[model samples]
Target: MRKFVLAAASSALLLSVSTQPVKADDDLLRLAISLCDFAKTDDRSSMRRKLKAAGMRLRAIYPAIKCGADGSLLRVATVNNAFEAAKFLASKAGDEAINAPEEDGKTLIQWTEGLVAAGDASKQQFVELYKSKM
Candidate 1:
């Protein structure tokens, strides 16, 4: 009888644990998206908070750093839909261009230098954040 009860309790615990949502990383990614969206819309305070919550790091000088780059990988940017995907990712991921692997063995910074030169405000905010550590 005791053995049966122990097995039942273990099963219940396992079932409960399995049913819990497993999306810590997903949540962070979502938050990163939100931060980028907010930045595109000129919502700085909220965007900053969202980026902070996601544990993102900014290594670039500003969103303009990559704003003009081909943004094909991010469908939102491909459409020129007002969403700065690179800026958002950089703010949260800490200079994806710095280490983002690619076919030409190029960093995100090198690939997006043209865009960065265009003076992206959203990316500039990230640089500020990186500097402030906020």
Candidate 2:
């Protein structure tokens, strides 16, 4: 009975440890997506700190992840005008991702343009950044 209990406890510990990384990755992704909304309420310094931390975690998980059709984190950041977060993501994503198209075939440049049309003059920096990469 003692050996059985010990074996079961060991199995449970191993299972918990194995599952921890997946949960942490999911949390990082959630935090990355929420960064856009967080930027709205937080000061730039606070936002930058959060963005940097999230970026570090995401980089560890996905060292080569780019702004592909599925990288909704970049899309959300750009759409919400989370410039600092977007920039941090861009740094990790590389130059090719700067113009990568979404599922609808729209690039980050197009998204920034939409913001510009809506009177968001601040997005010009993003536009220029995308263009420079292209």
Candidate 3:
């Protein structure tokens, strides 16, 4: 009977721990998405606030914002371009991508190819920035 009670108590503790929501990271992900938008719209103030809220230090949103204003894939791509995408990735996985590709199998540089092709200077700048960082 004592063993049964101990087992139940242990199971309850494990369940509580497992059920805890990862709220902070979730906020970071949401902020990443918002930052991508601000990058396109050149809303530097809003971007700063969002990054601050998410506890992420601003890294590369400037170039991405430039690209956004210059009409890059920021306006077209469902996901943010390579720059913003890479920024989010770096935030979640540390700053060393080391040639890591996105889930869609494209390197960050390759992912921004479309933006470059469209003559979006911001996207180009982002690609250059990513090259330097990588």
Candidate 4:
């Protein structure tokens, strides 16, 4: 009975350890959802508060948090025409994010150029923000 108890305890410990990452992923997902909503609504204050409360920077969590169909937070801001949120996100962007190709397999600059070429110059402010970060 004692050995069985020990085995059970060990199994419980292992199970808890294994689930840690899942919990972290869940938390990140929730954060991403909230961030996406804020970006979509152009609520820069809420976005700032959320990240501040979580003690995280946009750049640090950028790679881990996919902003729904828009892909990255920057893109979400872009699509929603949330210049304030876009500027905030860009200001906090990391080199990897600035340099990394977006979900459509093109660098941010390329994507912006394409959009401008298509007569969508609305994201020009975001481009300027990210350019400074770069």
Give the per-residue lDDT digits (tens) of candidate 1, residues 1-134: 00101124323433464544345434533553454445445454665576466444443212212222332222223223333443454345454433554445554444444344576544443333323322
Which pairs in model 2 have colliding backbones?
none
Q: Judge candidate 2 at residue 34 and give its lDDT.
A: 46
| Model 1, global lDDT | 0.39
lDDT of 2 by residue, 1-134 (tens): 10101124323433475668556545444544444344333334554576577444433332233233334455556656767766665665665555667556777688778888899888788787667655
Off by over 4 Å in 4: 1-22
Instruction: Encode model 4's per-residue lDDT on 1-134: one tens digit a residue.
Output: 10101123323433475658556545555676788888888899999999898666776667655664567777777878888887777777776777798668987767776777788877676677777778
**Candidate 2, which segments miss by more than 4 Å at Cα?**
1-71
Candidate 1, residue 40: Cα displacement in angstroms equals: 2.8
**Ordering by lDDT:** 4, 2, 3, 1
TM-score of 3: 0.41
Better of 1 and 2 by TM-score: 2
| Model 2: worst 10 consecutive residues (lDDT sum) | 1-10
Better lDDT candidate (1, 4)? 4
Candidate 2 has what TM-score? Answer: 0.50
Candidate 4 at 84: error in angstroms? 0.6
The root-mean-square deviation over C-alpha atoms between each candidate and the true structure, in angstroms, is 14.1, 11.3, 13.1, 10.6
